[model samples]
Structure formats: structure tokens, C-alpha cells
Target: MTKVTAQLSVSLDGFYAGPRHDGDGDWMASAESHGFFRVTRWVTEAMSWRERQGFAGGRQDVNSEIVAESFDAAGAYVMGRRMADGGEVPWGDEPPFRAPVFVVTHRPRERLVRQGGTSFTYVTDGVESAVAQARAAAGGKDVAVAGGGSLVRQVLRAGLLDELELHVVPVVLGTGMRLFDADLGLDEFEGIELTPTRVVPDPQVTHLRYTVHDRTPLTLDDRGAGTEKA
Candidate 1:
């Protein structure tokens, strides 16, 4: 089965986006205005995905490669209603997804077909159902949870996510939307059961990959013993 994965760019202090991001164009403007864009510069500055939206310059370096790999891994996407609505501004008529996107929302709307291969299907049935629909639409490829924070938290809390890739930026947005700001008591889970599988260091950000297993991961001593030469 294709892994249900999520990728997000978060600040060192755990903020994803700054406050006041209610589908307004300001969210994508200068960082001085929308602190969210400041943290997300890693993705927006390097990825060719920005070019698809009529942006001028983008990188082809390590960061861009990482971004490209993430894009290639997804056959379908699941995002919250805010992400879908917020994206319409910067994304124009042909959003960069270029694949089927299932949006989780309380308000249902007709399927929206955009230019390029992107299509938006609203789901009022919640995260699991949205994920199910995204996976089916994805065929055999991975269903990527492209987030706006709240939806990502919901999926994590539900234990539906198989992998979580966090691009940890160095900056700290003191007050903003946080990935673990929900009332789920995530403090009780981090570094205990959520095991880090890989860590790729970059100049601008660090890519931290974790696998969500049913039980806690091995301790340092256990891992050392498992790697001993026979």
C-alpha cells in the first residue's frame, strides 16, 4: 500500500503560519506582512513549482531536489479547506498540484476543475474519508497530505499518517498557527513513539523524516546492538 505521508515547513519554535490567514491574499505577500511566507521561503524560493505559477527565479540546488522528490512521490493530495481556498490567489487558475486534490471541509462544494491536471473535490466527511478518497484517486501512488496545519494535526491525531516529513527552518514565528497546537496532548507523544527515520541537513532547512509505527522505536542502546557486526 502507498504510504500516507505529510510534508510541512515549520519554524524552530513550531509555528507553521502566522495569525490572520483566513483565505486572504495577504498570506502570500511579503514576510513582513504574513510571517508564514518567511518560514516557507525554503519551498517557495527553491522549488520549480513556483515557476508554474508565473514566478521568476527558482533554484535547482539540493533544496529544489528535495522539493521535486516530494512532488514526484504524490499521486494525489489532501488539504484542508483553508489551504484550497488560500491557494487560489497565488496559484491562479492552474494550481501547482497537477493532480487530484481532496479538500476536507464542513461546507461542501461542487468539484472544481482547474487548468493543468489539478482538480478540487470537497469532502465534508472528515480527514479519514478525505484520505480514503485521495488514496483511491491516487491509484497506487502515495497520498500526500499537503497541509495548512489544522488538517495535518487531525490526520496525525487519528493515526492515519504513515510518514511525516518536516522541513525545519531556523527562524521562529513567536505567535502563529502551530502543527501541534491542538488539545491532543502531543507533548506526551513526541520523541517517545514518533521515531526519526532520516535527517537530511540543508543550508536553509533540515529535512527530518519520521515513521509512525504502532509501538515506540528502539532506544539508543537497542539500535547500537542491532547494528553490531556479526
Candidate 2:
């Protein structure tokens, strides 16, 4: 059976992005982060996959190896409107994802074809519909959800994710869009079950893989107890 997977980079402080600044230099909501580039620098700075996507230069080291695994055999992708937005940076003519990508948005649009075998199909219904479309497109391969926090939350909360690969960076973003936000909270004390599958350690960051299962009550310390042994 093909599993539904998601890959994300989180900070030591559990943030998916760095803090943001308002026009008047006042603090905005936690969701108002600068961007994920700074937080995900460990992977972006030394990833071979990035270079393969037409990026200039990056170290082809352990970090690169970890990053490469995500793009190896995924059949399709799903992302949120925010993730697809050009507010931060546009993905350029050709994105790293060379397969079909379903973008979840309220605003409907026609299919967008890009260079290098990548095509974006706008999905207006919801996450489940997008995942269903992605699964149909995958054809026995895994459905990889490239998230920006909120979408991943919906997928996980709806029990649609099968695996989660988290690359925990060493840096701390004091205030930002957190990967584990309270809005997606479960019943008090209810916990999401995660069985450690793999751990890839690097000097800059640590890649952890987990097989996600039904929700139960478990502490974060209990779930992640022995996962860092890489």
C-alpha cells in the first residue's frame, strides 16, 4: 500500500519559520513569520537536490543526502495556497518537484504547466479532495505533502498522513509559524502515535522519520525518546 508522506523542517523551538516584522515594527501573530528559508538553511545550503533543481552551489554532503531522499521516488505532491504563494519567493520556471502537484486553494484556476515535467493543478474543494487527486496521480507511489504548517496540520488532524519526515534544525526562532500549533490540538492528553523508522544525523541538522498511526495519549518525550540515536 502506498503511504501518504510529508516532509518539513522545524527549529529547535518548534517553529517552521522565523519571526516577522510589521510595517510599524510591531509584532504580528505567530503565523506572520518572515519565511522558512532562514529556518531551513541547513538543508537548502548543502543540498544536492537543490543543485539538481538548477540552484547554483550547495554542499553535496550528509545534508544533501538527507534532502535527496525526499525527491527520490515520490509520485505526486500537495501543498497549501500559502505555500504556493509568491509572497516569499517564486519557485521559478521549473520547480524541484518534477511530478504532478495539487495546490489547495479556495480560488479556482486552470491547470498550470511548467518546465521539467511539473504541472500545477489548482484544487478548490479541500485537503481531502487534493489528497485524493494526488493519490490518483501517484499510481502506487507515495503522496508527498510539501507543507507550510497549516496544511500539514489539517492532513495530520484528519488522519490522512501515513509518514512524517522532520528535519530539526539547531537554530531557534523565538516567534514564528509553529509546526505544532495549538489550533490543531487533540483532546486533552490525546497523543499522535509515531514509531521511529529512521534517523539521519548531520552536523547542521537531524533528520527523523516516523510511521504515523492512530491517535492516543502520549507525551512528546515518550514519542521521541529514542529517535535521536543516529
Candidate 3:
């Protein structure tokens, strides 16, 4: 069965991106200056990541293997419009993701066909629709929710995410874009649970994988109290 999975590199303080700026100039500069690169430095230094980006020479350690494994597991991807737009220039003609990518956005645009197997399909409806399309396109492989925080939160809140992989770096950013800044709006009766599946420790980063389990809401009694039925 195809599973919905998400991966992100976060700071020790739980920030994926740096602080938001007011104007485009400030934002662009801040994006570069902030802890964004620091948090993702591990992957950027990996041989697998370097190879995908058509670069030369990187470390072929455990981190590289993990990166390769993630890329191999994902057959299709779903991401937010902001992330897609931001990556367009950096990713160039041959994007790292060599699979069909569904972009969740309000504005409708024609499908973008790139070099290799990468193609961007803009989804105007919602995240759920995007994930559904990605799953269908995955061809029995896992659907990767490549995100910019908000998209990941939306998928998790909607109970569409099946697995989550967090690359926790040691450095702490005092102020930045937190991965869980907003409420997930989980069930009041029975909140969601994450079962730890794997953990890979490294000097620069710690890789943690969890299987998301949405628990059944508890039964309510006559007095509106929560109860578990026998």
C-alpha cells in the first residue's frame, strides 16, 4: 500500500525556517542569512543530495544513505505553491524530484513539464485533493509530502499523513518558523499518536521516523463525559 510521508530538517528549538520579513528584499535576504542552511546542512553535504543536484563530491556516510533511501521510497510528491515557486529557480531544468509533483495552490496554472521525469501539476482545490492525486500517481510507492511547514501541518491536521521523518539538528534558532506553530486541531476526545519506527544518530543530526496513528475518539456518556466502551 502507498503511504503518505513527510520529511523535514528542524533546529533544536523546532524551527524549519527563519523569521519572516516584511518586504520581498528583506525576506529574500533573511532566507539566506537565517538558519535555513544550517538546519539542512547535513543533507546538502550528503553524496546522494549532491548527485541529485548534479554537483560533485560530498560525504558518502550514513546521512548519504538515509538521503538515498528517502529519495528511493518516494514515487510522487505534493507540496505548497510557495515551496514550488521558491524551488523553481534553484531546482533549474532538472529538479531533484524525478517524479510527478502536485502543487496545492489557489491560482490555476498549466502543468509544467521539466527535464527528466519531473512534472508539476497545480492543484487548485486543497491539500487533500493534492495528496489524493499524488497517491494515485505514486504507483504503489510512498507519496512524499514535500513541504514548507504550513502544508505539512495541514496534511497532519487532516489525518492524511501516515509517516513523519524529522532530521533534528543540534543548533537552536531563537526565533524562526516553527514546524508546529499552529494547532493541529486534533480530536478533543482522542488525540493523534506517533509510534517511533526508527532513529539514526549522527554528530550533526539525528534522524527520527514515526508512524502516525490517529486514535478513535472516545465514546461520550450521558453526562457528556468521555468513556471507553467495553
Residue range 1-230, candidate 2, lDDT tens digits: 67899989888888887654436452333335444665678766865766866778888888887777777768899988867764224577888788899999999988988888778899999999999999999878889998878899999998999999899888777887788888666998898889999998887888899999998875666767768777
For model 1, residues 19-124, the per-residue Cα lDDT tens digits are: 6544435444644336677778888888465665677888878888888888888999999897787677768788888899999999979999999899999999
By lDDT, the better pick of 2 and 3 is: 3
lDDT of candidates 1 onward, in order: 0.82, 0.81, 0.91
Backbone clash numbers for all candidates listed: 0, 1, 0
What TM-score fits each model?
A: 0.85, 0.85, 0.90
Residue 49 shift from truth in candidate 3, angstroms: 0.2
Off by more than 4 A, model 2 = 20-35, 87-89, 217-230
Say which candidate scores most in TM-score.
3
Highest-scoring model, lDDT: 3
Per-residue lDDT value at 199 in model 3: 98
Which segments of candidate 1 are over 4 A away from where they belong?
Answer: 22-33, 185-192, 215-230
Clashes of 2: 1
Better of 1 and 3 by lDDT: 3
Ranking of candidates on TM-score, top first = 3, 2, 1
Error (Å) of candidate 2 at residue 30 is 13
Candidate 1 TM-score versus the reference: 0.85
